[model samples]
Target: MTGASAFPRWILPVMSAIAAGVMLALPYNYAGLYPLTWLAFVPLLVAAHGRSAAAHYWLGLLTGLAMYLVATPWMVEFLQRLKDYSLAPALAGAMVFWFLTAQLPAFLMLCWHLCQRFCGHYCLWFFPVLLMVFYGWFPVLFPLQLGESQSAFLPAIQAASLTGVYGVDLMIGISNALVTAGALQAMGWLPGARHTSGVMGGAGVLVLAAWLGYGWWALDHWDRQVSQWPTLSAGLVQSNETPSAAVPAPEPGYSRSWPPEMALSSQLARAGAEVIIWPETRYKGYFEVDQVPGAFQRAVAGLGVPLIFHDAEQQGNGGEFREYNSSLFLGPDGALAGRYRKHRLVAFGETLPLSREFPWLVNWASDYLGDFFANLTPGNDRVTFPVGGVHLVPAICYESAFPGHVARSVGAAPGSPLLVVLSNNGWFGDSRQPWQHASATVLRAVENRVSLVHVMNNGPSTVVSPSGRVLASTPFQERIGLVTDVPYTPAGQVFRSWFTQWPEWFAVVLGLAGLMALLLIRLTRRQA
Candidate 1:
């Protein structure tokens, strides 16, 4: 190939990686720049055009790493905390952090390769479909995806009800492909005329416009169709104290007691809140039939309202001793009503993946590092607590990130259950982690069409409506409380079925069918 005709292979990939990385990092860094999310993958797609599979794969991995580094800088804070321990462990933690970030990119590139082989030129159409299918099933660090960038845009987010987050992701992927194709042609990377590319580019713009228009229509239609339902008066307590097993214990008589903390809840209840919420694992003791903290029990009795709190439990015997991160419901009678263990554990943060086989590593980590994540066991059952006339589904920290986890927790209750998300984000401090974490709850509220009461240990606790609207919220790092009448939509919304049931599987089957049809077509053409 002539110099003019030859692809600037390295340069294109680098450009794609940088552009995609910056675009993704922009939304996370500054919420106002969320519009950048639409354009994030465009450069990457442009670079992928007429490139080798290996090149595309490498470019994708680099973009993912860069994006995570920029977006999740708080991850480094964990390493910084460990820095005083020693340099080697800190470096090891950093390596693990970067590797975790690279996971989705690696999987995405593999999907891209498969699509390319199956669909040929039409693979771009399946890009986002594959993404939705794989990502929904894949265990990701954060459930924050393309759909979340539009969290502020309620109309756009409303589509998440029909297709979950994947719907928005699909639109984004198609838009990027269209833009990439047009750009490639305009830049002479493709054989198509610039005019053809322009039309394609214009079509992509129209698609985006139409999407927004549909969102507007959906929002209007939803508003018209649903009758106003009852609102519950709920109170959320946001304490300044963040609970962590890794932190050093306060000196003797430094007692950070619950009496002072219960003051906020007591005031909220007297102000007419029907329920009160406490942050995750705020009560550090192991809650069991035999042993429950006296102070916590008394606080529950004093409140005279259903109080919700989470704790870390130590269960089993001897070598089988397993830890659980659980949320407990204490009735007005100060008795344990029900409990829900956190279903999805944070991979390395809550539970070590292969610790059963590597007991030595678990022992060492526990002995030296205070068992930060080596023992927490995953929960198997969904426990819903009844308050007044409604059931409350409990979602602990990290569990709120998973749409499926939230969906299952809600279940098919007699009435629309309110999702209560209890979290202690103090570990992250005044970082973007809290903001990013809040974004997921918004998506959950929309997807489940249920009002959510998010009670955080640090801050940013919010009461969200079915339409992804924040009814009330407290700012981050504040020691404050919130009282609001959280609105609930009627049961049997379309989203609960789609998200909880089969849309992802449908996408997968559709892609597989397309792949098979393409293979058959190729065979026929070869024969002819």
Candidate 2:
């Protein structure tokens, strides 16, 4: 076992490769239903045993490749969408998503490899810091840590209260380490073969106990919370409508001359909905304000309820006709009460950056970016409004992926509130895009301790609790579903307030610091 490091070069590398494949396919597929995402790292970690830094770096690259390739197939869509770019450039652009997202796993392996020689056998405990290093960062584009896989697992999730989502990720990493340790024991890599069996059994018991304890808490909380929950009557409408990505629209059905969407808004209102919600882009299609009567606004004002619509318009006259994606909140009286122009705009969908200036990038859209051509101006404010007697944050789209963005917005409020993510998932085309997007929302909901209602124009619009439990969701297409009343979490979840991805950083530093100290000690030994 000690000389195994000197074995044929292909042996460990092949094993490492096989492990990466299993790690990627097993955890993501249905049969591996368990959230064994962290388990994937076990073989990669094992491969690092008594290795050179260069060897460790290859291991890091391999880990990153497996994770980035499997976790995000959606990047292909971005590449395919850019018809003008060469296959290589488009692919490169798409791969930036991979480079940006996989820094944690890459670093995790590096940290583990650096410290293993010093830890002797204690390297198992060092992984808790790996979790911290990976989870910590600012403006995390796709902050999908290993813990997210266990969103369906309740036991390990109990740690969410202390460290938010990152804590659950930490515990799962620990569990995965235990599993890898057991595997190593079976291989006779460590001494005390007789005691290995007992130790492994104990670890199994600890994992099971932690899992069961958390499950009990979640079940108990659900049962008790439901009875005390205040019910509110609300109606949701998915208009399958598009305003401009800038032009505003009158109410869907009533634009003076019997618009195409006549029955939609009125039906939602008639359904006893105190607050009738509409999907994003309810006003995004080829319609101008002049097309509707000036009194059309007055007519909806009479509906006596709030209706949310996405507004878009191209700037006119001498200007380049800029476009805006916005959420329009009309008061019960139908007059425009408030608005949150979408803060985050899609790279190509909203406005292509610098494409207008460079021209070589090819401005593909029908609209202009700025006065001549620029990116759409993002909204500066996070608009939280009251409707149906609940305080809420209305995120238009894409903002859900950025948990810290929601936290920053919701943080301004005294406590957590119900959340409404008005979206047009219709664009994704029945692919796993909706699932990926919706899955990330759960992280945001749990992180903020808020009930989120994802109302979509096309598919996978769901209502999720602070725990990321799905209450109700529509299938693909022009569908309707009631969330009944989403439960508003009573304030105080650590993540909602804790802005820094500090836990991830601490892990990195700890691992790095530990490795450094051991190196210094080794140097002193050589001198002595």
Give the runs in model 1 whose Cα sits over 4 Å from its true position.
1-12, 82-92, 110-114, 117-119, 192-211, 223-227, 243-260, 286-292, 364-369, 490-497, 501-503, 510-514, 517-528
Model 2's number of clashes is 27
Per-prediction backbone clash count: 0, 27
RMSD of every candidate to native, in Å, equals 4.0, 6.3
lDDT of 1 by residue, 1-528 (tens): 898668674875797786798788767656678778767877777766666778777888888888877777666555455324455676666667776766676668666776666545555655656666555555666555766666777877776765667677667676667766656666777553456556645766786788778888877775554436767788888876744545444334433344334778888888888888888744455355243466666777887888887777777889777778888888987777788888888765676667879868777666655646556888898777888766788888888877666777775555668889988777765688877778767888777667788888888888877777777889888788777887655454423546554435444665576567667756764677
Clash pairs, candidate 1, are none
Alpha-carbon lDDT, every model: 0.70, 0.59
Give me the displacement of residue 271 in model 1, in angstroms: 1.5
TM-score of 1: 0.87
Best by lDDT: 1
Tens-digit lDDT track of model 2 for 250-270: 554455334433346666566
Cα-lDDT of candidate 1 = 0.70
Task: List the candidate 2 regions with Cα displacement exceeding 4 Å.
Answer: 1-15, 21-32, 82-104, 117-120, 135-141, 188-212, 239-263, 282-299, 312-325, 341-374, 414-416, 478-483, 489-528
